[model samples]
Target chain A: MNAATTTRRESIGQSPRALPNTSSVPPRSLPNDEQRLLARLRQSDEQAFDELVTKHHGALIRMAMGHVGDREVAEEVVQDTWMAVIESLDRFEGRSSLRTWIFGIMIHKAKDRGVREKRHTTFSDFETFDEEQEDAVDPSRFHRSGEWAGHWAFPPQPWDDQTPERLLASQQAVQAMNRAIEALPVTLKDVLILRDVEGVEAKQVCDILQITETNLYVRLHRARERVRRAVETYLEGCQRAV
Target chain B: MAHDASQSVHEEITCREVVEWTSAYLDAHVGEDRKQQIALHLAACAGCGAYVGQIASVRDLVRLLPQTVDSPSESEQVRQAVAAKLRRQ
Candidate 1:
């Protein structure tokens, strides 16, 4: 009945746990093939385990690398993640695809290991960013107010190679892009690898990374922009060589 | 204050806002009304239009590229190791 007690109870009612599950994201469906694999995995089928590892191992290692930023530690994380996956097979419901669920576990384990190793930078650990600051573009392009205000001052440089845009997907360019992706900061790299590289659904990525859709959007755009710059640089160098 | 991209900046969405919404738009996650706003902005804003086009191509290039960006193979040994580890569990 006291004033302080009443206020405390009201605050608790407004806490995140008290909030309704109003997330717009829908859980990804487990494909029929994935269900069969999940069943086999639960029964400890060796072939099923091997197949899953073969499919996911490389991407998982790259994902772990994003968390730990070290090859050896990342490998260890992947190994530990596989162990966890195997042990928890029986507990998996068909809610999300097996891959997303596995990533959910991997990210959690990776975060813990990264934190212990002093590399896990949660949101509070870093400064906030204006997701659309246009840092790469010149400020003089836009005027204060007019018909053209808040619009492009000039056309952006063509991202495609001058030689031939099709050649942008050539082996050399992909190799350059790969290096660029590897060099990105952890969060950016994570979003890029998962959503862009592995082609996971954005909703699934949000779940795995435990970030809001907005945060994922920013990370993905920045990550893609960074890789595009690297590719553009490579193409320009190639042009110069010719 | 206004709803048109051709009109004054009373209620125009900035280039910055478009950039912020770029990924989500590409993912088809933005609402229909906001999607229309972006389309209007792109129609009128050449700079933002080019920016959007370039970023979209980057996404296309990425999709065309291989899945694994580094150490492109998951090596037979690694798979075997994982299987063995799981077997022991």
Candidate 2:
């Protein structure tokens, strides 16, 4: 096996079980640290609150930006979310993880703000994409009717010596990925941001977005494919210039 | 039509299917039976192998990219606001 394939295998081995049978498993409880943090926050401990905000603020802003389309507005939405969290802290039932609850509140506020601004598309607006009908990768990349039907007609060229560090090192490539992510429909964008960008677990992402695991995977794949396509296009352009 | 026997043997799962399942496969979400099919296919098909590897790279790289940053002053402003609100309550 090639080095890339070996790496892929090892990575898969290390992955958390992505699709747990939620029905069979008990609902997740707050981790002890979160429980202690909640207790401290309830006691009006400024340090605890500060740590909470610091931990989640950047991701909240990024996620809100995906919905509100303005950094300032996104920041405001997150601020409002923090305010809501404080107001509702005593009422928090621990039905979900604290992070999930916090994110859920931010998404609610961001979507409302997004609607008021009318600059950003809401999740309902994504109905037009028809998730069932859309193929994440371009169909033309696959072969037509033949023994090789459904095989790659135009397979992606392996990126030479590509590593995350190498990919991020390229200013143009980074911009390409950022643009691609920004252009995604909000539904796709939410899953990517929550699951990949923010490192939220698969199950919590579903809770935050009110989506099923199946829905999460579908949207996540499509989102990643778009970013991958952006990088591929950028690399192809670089090759052509060379 | 002549084809490589090694490639043909593993064509039970198509490249299109593998591409679609790439994310789930990388996350180890697929069923064992289907996972074996994909693994067998990837072992033989360099195209699918490259495609999956790129998608994996993209997934890992995205979180490492510089995300939206709140200026230190802005963050402090937020902290102060939250602190004040907590004090009031």
Candidate 3:
């Protein structure tokens, strides 16, 4: 192998012998990429840090916005998070993805900022109406008094020809899904952004949101159902159009 | 729910109940008994089964989208600023 490629690999915590057989590992895990990135970040490499910031800055803002409400405050929280990330570099142990580690810091900062600004109530106030919110399954769509009572009134059809290809090619359907995400209740929106958008685990979502497991489950399920309904609605619209 | 009235207590969950419990089942948060109840409901109910599939698709599609919905240009600016600050520190 060339000297540069070997150097890059070794920089990422892989020995020269570890180079040939990466097929067993998931490409997305990219332990080598992370290790190299972490090393560069530790040394305050400007270009390396810029790449990391570009990849995750938007996500950090959205997560901070979940707690702080105001966009400006959210931006501030994200900026503060970067500072904290710099300070906490020594504590990172590769136990979790670097993304998750940085996010944990952002969540902590956002939550603290929210509390200091008395915005925590905005984050927590929705729990009371949690019961009154529409359920994942609309009761009106179910029968009320027969063998199928409480069952689906209309069968759930495939969003398209039951294929991922159709959905991927349909711009309207994609737009509908994005719109639905934006329209969700803030409580559900936050959970969806973290769990689905940020790709955080459910357990970690609970910790970040300071919600119970049950609450996290409810919010996540409701978010998924709503997004599914958007695709369903788009398909129905296309059917009517046809 | 009434249809299951004649079934054993373990199989008494309705479509609505199963819908409410679906996330619990998927997340493995419910007890084994409740898991069986949901399983029985899904086994017998085509609609509920489809609901499970559709939600999985929803998750897949969302993951396909960018992790953040903020405009790309704005994100670029934020990243540049953050990088500059990190270097200054």
lDDT of 2 by residue, A106-201 (tens): 887787788788645455433336679899899999998888999999998887664567779988888889888877888888899889988888
lDDT tens readout by residue for model 3, A27-145: 34448878777777777787877787777887788667656667778887877777666655654555456776677667667766876766334644223236447677777877888
Which residue ranges in model 1 land beyond 4 Å of their true spot? A1-29, A119-147, A159-169, A238-242, B1-10, B67-74
TM-score of chain A of 3: 0.69
C-alpha RMSD of candidate 1: 8.6
Which regions of candidate 3 are displaced past 4 Å?
A1-37, A65-73, A91-97, A108-134, A160-163, B1-9, B66-68
lDDT of 1 by residue, B1-89 (tens): 01223433345788866776777788877766777878888888767776787777777676566655335344465667766866676
Alpha-carbon error at A117 in model 3, in Å?
Answer: 8.4
lDDT per residue as tens, model 1, A1-242: 22222212212222222222212322235666766666677667888888888777878888787777667788878777777776555545445667777776777677778777664445433223465564534456555578757556654565434433564547787778777777777788788878987789887788777777877877888888787677667867877999
- Candidate 3 at residue B3, lDDT? 26
- The better candidate by TM-score, 1 or 2, is 2
Number of clashing pairs per prediction, in order: 0, 0, 0
Most lDDT-accurate candidate: 2
> What value of lDDT does candidate 2 attain over all alpha carbons?
0.77
What Cα-based lDDT does every candidate model obtain? 0.67, 0.77, 0.68
